[model samples]
Target: MTVVAHPTDPTPARAPAATRTAGRIRGLDAARALAIFGMVTVHFGPFPVRGDDLASAAYRTPYGRASVLFAFVAGVGVALLSGDGSAPRVRSAGRRLVLRAALLFPLGVALQKLPTGVAVILQYYAIYFLIAAAALRLADRWLLALAGSLTLAGPMAIVLAQRAEPSWFDAGGNVGIRAPVALLRALVISGYYPVLSWAPVVLFGIWIGRRDLHAPGVHRRLVACGAG
Candidate 1:
């Protein structure tokens, strides 16, 4: 007796990554737009309540939130640029990031000279960008862990620094380009957007960007975690 063999169906191929509209992620753009708009309002919007200005809708809603989103977005951008841990490309990207940081340092100082009322972020952002180069090769879990660690450590350091030197953070408006010591202090420990505390957000973003963001499971997790 001879037995017949049955044929099995072939596996299906996966579709390529999807982008919103065309060649871009609308969700990212929308979040960025919210951040930018919030920052603008925080700076240029009116203060109906004198000493209570900070508690106003604009400041209360976006003052810190926008900056966090902006930093996270920046990290995500870097992760994408690095091709999600592609070492060879990250090396080349790191060079570009270094040059960009160099340019931003002076530009931030220059912006300070312009008498802009808002606290400038470019200088601190430059430092954050440079630091990111060192961690570009870390796995997503490690990046997330570091972010969590930094988040906890940042506030503690801030408290200690304040106790050590209360006046170190006060800028009296803007510290000119000549004040390197004050500038460094502000970048590391104090200032509206201290890289000390904010660095974690950036790392978390880099980790998030490396994941399969378009997938339903990932999206669900992002929403749940973001809300938490």
Candidate 2:
């Protein structure tokens, strides 16, 4: 008796290994550049026109909102750079994170001394890198769960800390000078871009990465999400 090939049988030509990696998404790059430009404008305090109040709406309106956009875009960048769920690629990404963190830590500390009351986001970005490293290793479902829980817990943690006495975690005082520990705590608590609140955004990016962004449907989804 002769046996026939089954319709469900795997075909060598259709294997994933046969496909090449997708090209970089230019739209994402453009979005990132725009985010960076907005961040600069927000941080630099407008054009500082002569004899003006220097506190015009253009500068004030964008300051906090622009920084939040930058943080969200940074999360997308992290997800894009990790090549979605690929392990080997993410390991290399983790190394890059360490190098960037090492370089930015000192600069961040120095910037804190300035009168502007700004905490350089690179410091927080570095801490996010460390958290992402661990988060990336988990299953996608678990990653999302962890991200959601942390996002909710972050504000509550700060609230509880505030009520607990001493209040070292509060946004005032010498808390900025404590180096690594301070950096880690700020990333979780007082900072606007706290890791707990922001990690879910990154994990969302990771989930986005799992989809085929080059597809028209995916692009539309991205636009909708970005708009929201």
Q: How many residue pairs clash in each candidate?
A: 0, 0
Overall lDDT per candidate, in order of appearance: 0.72, 0.61
Give the alpha carbon lDDT tens digit for every residue of 61-146 in model 1.
78678888999999877766676345687798788788889999888878866855767788878888898887786654456678
- Highest-scoring model, TM-score: 1
Model 2 lDDT-worst window of ten: 11-20
Checking candidate 1 for backbone clashes, the offending pairs are: none
Off by over 4 Å in 2: 1-21, 47-57, 169-184
Residue pairs of candidate 2 with colliding backbone atoms? none
**Which sections of candidate 1 miss by over 4 Å?**
1-23, 49-59
* Candidate 1 TM-score, true structure as reference: 0.81
Model 1 lowest lDDT segment of ten:
9-18
